[model samples]
Target: MNATATFDPFSPDAGTHQGGALDGHALVQGDYGTAVLGYDLASQVLRDKRFQNSALRLMEEFGITAGPVHDFRARSIIMLEGDPHLRLRVPLARFMSPVTVRNTRDVLRRIVESINADLDDSAPVDFYRGVAQRIPSLVYCHLAGAPASDAPQVQSLSERTLSLLTRDRSLTPVIVEAYDELFAYLAGLIARKRAEGLGDDMLSYLISLGDEGKLTEQEVLTEATSMLEASSVNTAHQVGLVVWTLLRDREAWQRIVADPELIPAAVVESLRLFPRTGVVSKIAVEDVELEGTVIPKGSDVHVAVWSANRDPGRFERPEEFDLDRERNQPLTFSTGSHNCLGQGLAKAEMEEVVRHLAEHYPDARVVEDATRIGQAGGRWLVDRLTVHMKP
Candidate 1:
């Protein structure tokens, strides 16, 4: 059945009215083209090899430039497939190894401490700008071996690129400019690292790999920029949303504060309720049958993570934010080959920040009603989360 309907996937009510797996999936006429929206179907599409991350190509097809923005994406691991995908991902796996995680924990803890120390206690603080926005950039930049001085500039460029990437619109000159600036920055960063000799950090690791001929200079830049983008972009918004979810819910906050061990579970539940990266798209390489519907070859299918995470069939009382939910699996990170490579780092950032707040500000609560902002790209972001806490 082909039903052409316009949908505001980015709307504040995007997932609230959705219930059950059956209701989660639908074919809607989107601004770019047709899109598939549903939990079970979206999960399947993500895991299916036939459904691929070809959005860059699709954008080009729709008259977007194949310039620096496209070049970076094409070279980045995100767009690679099959052997090339594995080849790019293999060495990078070292960055997320058990040893790396253990090493980064202290850095993350310190970042939380620093951010927390700068905030005023009694007045309502804009957590989104003051705290959440700073964590990802600082943590990821520290891990990437980039100089602290470079973060503000890199961060500004990265945010613009991310916004352009996720939103649905014609590519504007501004985004293209961001890509040019970012490419130059990453390239220059690599050159400096090579001149100074390599260190053990991710940037230096990639440089070493390039010297050994495992990756080309362009590929190295792609990898470094990919890490910068992954580590700095979505995670900040996720951190904010998760914190909002817990603090707004008194019971959930208390549970986490009482048992610090429950912090991880709270993070998971927050992801389920309000996934920050709400939608991911894939192109069907061949005709695919999903939930009694046939998605034709070349079709652009949008996997709505926001709807998927809240499917009633997948979770009991899907709307309720229950930290103790027994089966709390979420597709916020996507799945299959293209699943998020920075999941571990992102999780660590979320857990550490939430744990710090729970311990230090037990009585903390959102001072004003939070506003939900929707992006044209189907992202549900928390606009301003003002929280009242004791010093």
Candidate 2:
């Protein structure tokens, strides 16, 4: 199977799946013989109860299974499902309550300004370094109530953990060490939050839950570790890519600057084109049929959300980066059992960041080629982006 592995994208070559013509990649439209492509609308059915999610299947695809082995060290709601997943989500949802999110806007605004204060105006400073990465980190750190000193450490851990994602899991010890440091740091924070009680901070929110017994001390540490990566790393790579895409496409750049309203659409379109979040692995339980293909019981199923978003049948000119094109919503936040819980907060972050860029730095343009970081899930960026604007 390793010999037959190939990457699929919903672009011009996408005629294979949705354009009514199978080309390149030997993609069999409806053939179900061990093919990785979505022959049966995998996403639609995975959440359906007819199928089961088994742990053995997960072990094949992802080393980490969702079950709690020895307490909840890395166990997060993202890994859980059904009743267990729902139980955790219910309490966690309170942290992201709309009232709470609304209150964070001013903080977000200030964060963007503080990070972007000194642009590399000489030529093009690396946007990733200057603002894209910093804003999200600062915003999340503030929300979590992490101390000033821990912000940089949290950022480093996010970067290192993401780096391990793309690897073949060969560097286990290094990855283990990276996580050890991160979890240890979070564990300490949890202790602090427990003593301090609920306050006007993200730590306080978690502490409130602990007091209510909604979250255990162990769960608190696990969630803190999960929260930082989910909040910062993806946003950093995403914003960097979106900015790069717009800068290259003159017309798209103009559209954003002129209307500013289209930024949200652009954000969605960008996610489909250059997904920076994840290429998740889902475990399958019972045997499933799709387009004449039967995935045997206990199999590791990989659904390419990014690839699905690019399907020509669902999207016209699927690969051309057309924000105005009529298409179904991309799975950036996903749907059903494991949708992103922080989606509401993430959207607000993207909207605020983009709005600020257009309104504040209308003249910003790319000065050099953007270099993207290649990690497990494809979310890393380093580039020199020169923006021309008033300081």
Per-candidate total of colliding backbone pairs: 2, 5
Kindly report the root-mean-square deviation of model 2 from the true structure over all alpha carbons: 4.8
Off by over 4 Å in 2: 1-42, 49-74, 326-328, 368-391
**Candidate 2, residue 313: lDDT:** 58
> lDDT of all predictions, in order shown?
0.76, 0.61
lDDT string for model 1 (1-391, tens) is 5535556565656554464343334556555555556567667778888887875775575456566677777667877788998988987886778788778999989988998889887788888888888888887678778877776776677687766655545655666777678778888887888788888888888888888999997788888777776667688788888888888898878878889999889899988877878778778889987656677898877777887787776788888888779968899999888888788788888999888888888988886555454444567666777888763
On lDDT, the leading prediction is: 1
Candidate 2: deviation at residue 389, Å? 6.1
Ten-residue stretch with the least lDDT total in model 2: 25-34
lDDT of 2 by residue, 92-127 (tens): 677788887788888888877777677655555667
Off by over 4 Å in 1: 2-12, 22-38, 61-63, 166-171, 370-376
- Candidate 2 whole-model C-alpha lDDT, 0 to 1: 0.61
